[model samples]
Target: MRHIQRIHINVKSFICPNCAKSFKDNDTLQTHIKYIHECERNFCCRECEKTFVSSSDLNRHTQMVHMNLRRFLCSTCGKTFHTSSNAKRHFDEVCGKKEKKNGNS
Candidate 1:
């Protein structure tokens, strides 16, 4: 004899009253409200008209275009990477003989 259990997953939904746009994630919905309805462009690029939500994102964009530096480097294969995690991923995929996080070899 076996008992079967049914699991129900609740899908979260959000509705934007101002713009009539809906989203599943609260963070995205908040961002939409702040940027679209309020028109609050707090994060502005010094060199261009592009704006972002955080300073770290703007810093990364500046480093990528203005500094022209590849911060991450693969020690195993001597290959340059843009970010440290990407370097680790390349090492794992190429030399360490490990499958990617997606589990596809």
Candidate 2:
């Protein structure tokens, strides 16, 4: 309940000593330290023999690299991209405001 409360309240109690990043829960903080700082790749892809620090990353790599799944498509040019962020970037370059520079619109 305390962990859930921290997330809802946006109170980051656990702070990483190495990078000074904050997490709402201890488990997330520990995972960040293990994966980001320690570079522990627990999940591995057998097909490509590549390792990922997290399972979701391994899944994304398998879908994009091995399966060649480009789910996101740019509406303007009809270009395909593996990630939604890439598609949105292409869309912004094509139709919307130019890609952000120095965090400005």
Candidate 3:
């Protein structure tokens, strides 16, 4: 058997002074400040009181709940979906759906 040497370590170094918060990564600490205390919830849902950081999320929620509009239709199966990607996925994986020549399915 080989002999091994032990080492001592001191790893409690990075601390946030403003909130007495500590993180292993500085980017996490900055994200906490920007997201939690900056009052920058840019995306607000129209159907409910939910808030998000991106507008795409709010638009998705609005399309799902408030508008209830389905723009995607399967050509062979005659199934309707809210988003084009979902419709395409169903056509490829689900059943009986074919893509039109114009790719409108």
TM accuracy, model 1: 0.51
What TM-score does each of the candidates earn? Answer: 0.51, 0.56, 0.46
- Residue range 6-105, candidate 3, lDDT tens digits: 1133333446667777655566777777766674777888668799777887887888778997888887778899988899889777663334544665
What is the C-alpha local distance difference test score of each model? 0.70, 0.84, 0.70
- Residues 11-90, candidate 2, lDDT per residue (tens digit)? 88899999999898889999988879999788999897899987999999999999999999876557899999988877
Candidate 3 ranges with C-alpha deviation above 4 Å: 1-39, 96-105
What local lDDT does model 3 show for residue 100? 54
Clashing pairs in 3: none
Better of 1 and 2 by TM-score: 2
Worst 10 residues of 2 by lDDT: 96-105
Clashing pairs in 1: none
lDDT assessment of candidate 3: 0.70
